[model samples]
Structures are given as C-alpha cells and as structure tokens.
Target chain A: MVLSLTLLFVLSSGADGRVMHIKSLFASPLSEPRVGAQRTINLSRGTKVSVVTTQDPWVRIRFAAGTGWVLNAVLSDSPPGKTSSLLDSGADVSLNARKRVSGFTSAAAARGLREGADDFSGSKFRPDFESVRNMEGGYVNPDDGYAYILNGRTR
Target chain B: MKQHVAAAFFVLTALLPVAGAQSGAPALSRARAHQGVISTEEDHGDLTAEIRFGRALAARILGQYKLSADDKTGGYVSRVGAGLVAMSGRPEIRFHFGVIESNEINAYACPGGYVFITKGALSLMSGEAQLAGVISHEIAHINRKHVVRALKIHGGGGSFASGIAAMIGGTSDSSRVILGSLMDRGMDLLFKDGLSIADEFDSDADAQENMVAAGYSPAEYRRYLQKISDAGPGKTTSILSKTHPPLAGRIERLKQREGRLGENARN
Candidate 1:
C-alpha cells in the first residue's frame, strides 16, 4: 500500500507528453532513486518506454516489461516516422504558398543539394562540379549496412 | 489537511491517463488533460519545426554537394550509419544517408536525419570503424539537434507545420520570402561550419557513445582526429578545422570521456 502511494505521489510530479526510447545500451538503470545503484535490469538500445516521472538523471517509466527507473540520458522523445514532413507538418502554413516548390529537391537529386548550397553562397562553384553531376541513387538495403558493421568493418 | 487534499487531487489526475489508455486513447498527460485555461501545445510543436527546418537544410546541402558517382558508396555509408542511428535516441526519425563527391575530408549532418560524408573523408577511411566514427559524429549532431537549438528556431507562431512543410517543399514566393530569412540563417551555418564550440564538443562526445553502443571502438575516432591533425597542411583540414575547436582540445576531451565510459561500463 505504501509502495503504491509512493508511486502515485511520484507519477503526479509532471513529465507528460514524452514517449522516449532507449538511445544507448550504456544507459544503466538503478532500482533506487540514486544513479549507479546496484544494476537490477539492463535495457537494450531501442526499447520503448513511457516516462511517468523525472528526477534529474533518473526517470520513472512504464513499459510492457513493467515500470522501472532509468537514466534520462537513454530516453529520446523522437517517435519513428514522425519527421515525415509530407504528413507531420500540419495543415496551417499552406495559406499563401505555391503548389510546387522546385527548391525541395528529391532525395535522388544529390547534385541538387550542391547547387542549392552554391546558389545560397552567391554562385561560387564547388570544386568538383563534374563529380556532383555523377551522383546517383539506387535500391539501398539497410540490412547490408548491418552486416558490414556487425562483421567489424566500416567501409 | 491541504497536503492530503492536493495529494488526492493529483492521484485523480494521474489516473486520468491510465483510464484514457484503457479506453483506447493515446495516454493523456495531466498537462494536456487539464489546461485550466491556457494551452501548452505551442511549445510542443517546436520539435516538429526543428525537424522540418533540418530537412530543408539537408536538401540545400545535398544541392550543394551533389551525390557521389558511386551509388554503392551511399549504400555502404547508409548501412554503417543506420546501425549507429538505431542506437541513437531518435531512431524514430528516418535517416537518409548519402555520400557527397567532394575531395574534402569532411562529413556533415542536416536535421531530420540527413547525413552526408564527402568522398575525400571516405577515401581516407581505412576501415568501417573510421567511417562509423565520422558518420556517428554527424548523427550525434542530428540526435542532439545542435544546429536548430543554436539558431533558436521555435515551432508555431503561424509558422506551423503547413508553413514549415510548404517552406521545405513548396516553391511559392511567399514561402521563399518567409522561409528565406530562416533558411538563409541556416545556410550561413552550413557554409561557415558555424556551430558553437559547445555543440561540437557535445557531438564528439555523443558520437563516441553512439559508436560504442553500435559495437565499434571510440578510439578509432581519436585515431581519425590524430591522422588529420598530423596531416596539418591538407585540404580536408581547411574548412572543417576552422568550424571546430583545436584538434588537441577535442582529443583531450575524448580521452577523459573514454575513461568515464570505461568506468561506467564496468560498474
């Protein structure tokens, strides 16, 4: 009963709207209020958790695994796919804007980035103008990257 | 008596989210559920603004550097980078990793998960670890929102998501006029490498953390720094060196962090 009341008291302390996830495996969680306490559970990177409360470095969170205390360092409010500007940027700024903004280059327009940067800088051409034209994109599978790094080679 | 009353009221408030969750609604916080009279949603949308602006800069940067002729290089860097970003706090943001075909040994990140490394930097990289170091460093910047925070760009105030979204992709004159002012400041940051010293240090430190988390050695980053520093009179060092603190200072800071991280890992 006392434990439940303590939980209640802590929960009401404010830290709402934040739903962060584990950003680093180095995030060691403490069972007690103080940090570096006897490590009870080790959270893997990318584990999602809802922050119930925060106290400096420690945050009390609720997860499917159960409620626990973790460091604020491990948490990030960045929910996946939230940055999809095609969707997330709500319907407010379209009042007087044009339908097509050519400045918004496609991801495939690698050289477009160069040109935009050059134009912004008052037309000082980049050293490798030819190379920029040669830039291209293809079907990139992220899994290939995972295999390379896990194999212990970066390039 | 007042303490009990307040406690009871808070307890009722706290359970509101739990009840809402049960009814199949997104968990509502006390701040959202009970605004009394004022809405705090304005400050909330700032994160959205920061991301949209970062993407705008990311596109501008791509337009400046152009993608490399080697399509395979982007795939390679993307893989290494994705691994580290998976370990970042904001893995939720889709990261578009590309390689720039420049001879300068440099790597930069625009907001909203757009990271780029010049061909020069990639050519000098001996192995995946060094690549991870550079990519992770840039990822660290995006994760920390260093550039956006430096510019003091806030969300809303009539420049809501539509405005930001339109500004990023729309070609309208109004969008350019309004967003031009904001993007112009951001562009200056991009060309001059004008991130504050503190943000650079923070990115370096955080990059190390991301590297280690992804199972690469942070020492490799220090080694990369040493390599460039020793080269001294190279094209790679020209612009990147100016925007950042001295190489010696950065290495020292990393060395200290290495010790702390080691201790933290052990305990």
Candidate 2:
C-alpha cells in the first residue's frame, strides 16, 4: 500500500505535460537555463514527451529532442490541432490509417480552421476567427504559471 | 477646401496622440489629470471598449494566418506565454498565444491579449529566453496598446471599424473609402510600414523589463535581436526585413544595457 501510494503521489505531483503541436521550437530542456547551457537539440511541433518531475513552474521532461527542462506553461495537457493532417488525393480526410504527414493542398484552406467546426475542407473564411482567438486565450493562470517557472529549466 | 483641410488637421492631430497617448502607456497621473472632470466610474466603460476592439483585431489576424495544425506546438507557445503574462504587470488580461505556419519570420500583437509568432521566427530562436523576449515584446505591445492606438481615430472615439469612417464622413468619396478601410491600414503596419520607430524602441525596453521580471535572461533577448540583425535582408516581402531595419540602434541600446541583465537577470 505504501509503495503504491508513493508512486501515485509521485505521478500526480510531477504530473506529465505533453509537448504541444504548433509551428514553434522549444529550448532543449536545458541542463541549466543559461547561456552555455543552451542545448542544440530542440522539440518541434507534434513530438510528445514525458515529464519526470517539476520544480515550481518549470517542468522537467527527459526527452531526446534536446528539451530536458521547460516551463510548465509550455506544455499542453491536450493536443491543439489534432484534426489537421495532410491527406493525399482520393483518400478520405478522416482516414488515420496513413502514417505520412504532408502539407496543405490549398493555400486558402490552410489559412485557418474551417468556417464551421465540421467543415474540414478549411477553404472558407468565417467572420468569426474562433480557432485563432482560442489559441490566444489558452493561457495558464499566473499563480500556476509561476509555480511552473520555479522548476528550473534543466535536464 | 480650407475647411476640409482644417477638419483633416483636426482628425490627424486627434490620431497622433500626445506623449502619453502616443506611447500607449499614458502615465496614471496624466490620465487622471486629463480626466480630472470625469468620473472614475466611467473608466470601466473605456476598458470594456478597449477589450472589445482588441478582440476584433485579433480575429482579423486569425484571418491572416490560421493556427498551426500541430496542436501541441500551439500549446507549448501558450505555456511560455502564460508564464510571461503571469509575471507581467497586467496579469489580468487573458493573453492568447499562437504560432502561424507562415514562413514570414514575424510576430504580431493585437490589442487586448492576442499574440502570433511565425514558424520562421521560431526557427531562428536559440533558447526559451529568446522566445520569451520576442513574446515579451509583443506582450508589451499588447499591454501598451500601441497597435490599438495606431488603428484608432480619435474625436468620435468609437468603434475602430467605424471611427475613421465617421471622422472623414464629409470628405471626398476617395477619402471616404480610405477612411473606412481600417483593415488595410492595420495590414500596412503588420506587413509594410511597421510601428513608428519610437514605439519599437519603447517596446524593446519594456520587453527586456518584462523578461527580467519573469526570471528570463534579457541577454537572451539581446542575443535573439543580434541573430535577427546578423541574418540581414530576408525575403523581399518579409515583415521583419522591412520594418526592423532600424534595429542597429536597437542593438546598440540592448548592448549598452547588457550588463544590467547580468547572469540571472531576474528578480
């Protein structure tokens, strides 16, 4: 019982945060957050990593993409654009069987999320830029954010 | 014609905010003095309107570059952004963070709390502090409402979409078209002319302060600026290329204060 409790507390306390999918790069979860400490490896959008521990606001994830420690604010509990994928001609957009990821077929479509949530074609423009706006609003509370930052940016 | 010119002058001056207003961060004392006769109770109304206007502009930027298809990347940015905002002077505003897929090498801030960074810009970054620096600058812009000030036409002090239209209502037909097109003017700032050089410098100073406040190294911010400066001219149409050329002075300013940022640089 004690072992299980310890494991549960460990998992919950240093809870895992997944790498968010977007078009930016992340610092190597540095050996330390400093000038010489900058790691060459970085995590790009779509790679999933796990957290080993957290020191305050900094989340410590041991991963190969070079990001060893990152701010807790950098990780997302959920993936953002899961439905967005590159589909080949004649293949259904919904089909997940294909492993290959490609760029958008249409420039207009790729400009934003669909006009409506269900419209995956992504070609039409809606007056309401919901997807864009939502991405901006996805902020962690300051108190929570500071706690994450307290975690050192290190390996 | 002179009457028209006089009216135009009035409108232009209204648009060209004074020291406090032009900076977008009017001193509290100045604001209070300006509003000496007015009730503080009405301040809330102005804030509400400001937030509403910011939201509309953010939506328009979304129209420019949709969110990246990779959700985690968006999430990652938000996390970094949230950390910065948490440490900022204005933590109450719910700031939004997004990475546009365009290779433009740019970042933009909309009033209210909307910020967008491009993949090209991210590709150029070396560390989290650099990212925070770039973002802190944008957040400063947002916090200061610089772009919002630029977009706004005073006098009537109403909806951005309609304020300019209202200001130039009695003018010639061509001017009316120009007056109505706020989006065109806003785009010009993002894609062409960029903010007034003064605004950029002010934001740079503010960004460094915010980065330090958030426990990130301002030197990283300086390093990022150096990298961008070293890259020189990029795509002919690149936003950074066109607007940020004045960065030599900016670089000098950062270098002058590099020692202040120090090793830890944070409080």
Return the top candidate by TM-score.
Answer: 1
In candidate 2 chain A, what residue range of length 10 has the lowest lDDT sum?
A: A80-89
Q: Which candidate has the top score in DockQ?
A: 1
Model 2: per-residue lDDT, tens digit, B1-267?
523432332233323323333334433221111010112323333343344445555556677777786777776777778777655424325566788878877898875567889988888888788888999889767655666567653232233223223323244444334332544455556666677666677667667755755667777887887787788767822678666546678888876554443345432
On the 0 to 100 scale, the lDDT of residue A108 in model 2 is 22
Q: Estimate each model's TM-score.
A: 0.62, 0.56
Candidate 2 interface RMSD after superposing interface residues: 14.4
Q: Per-residue lDDT tens digits of candidate 1, residues A17-56?
A: 3677665533445565442346556676556777777653
Interface RMSD of each: 8.3, 14.4
For residues B125-226, what per-residue lDDT tens digits would candidate 1 score against the true structure? 787777888887887677666665555556545334343333322244433344445566566665664576766777777676666656667778888887
Runs of candidate 2 with Cα error greater than 4 angstroms are A1-128, B1-41, B153-180, B261-267
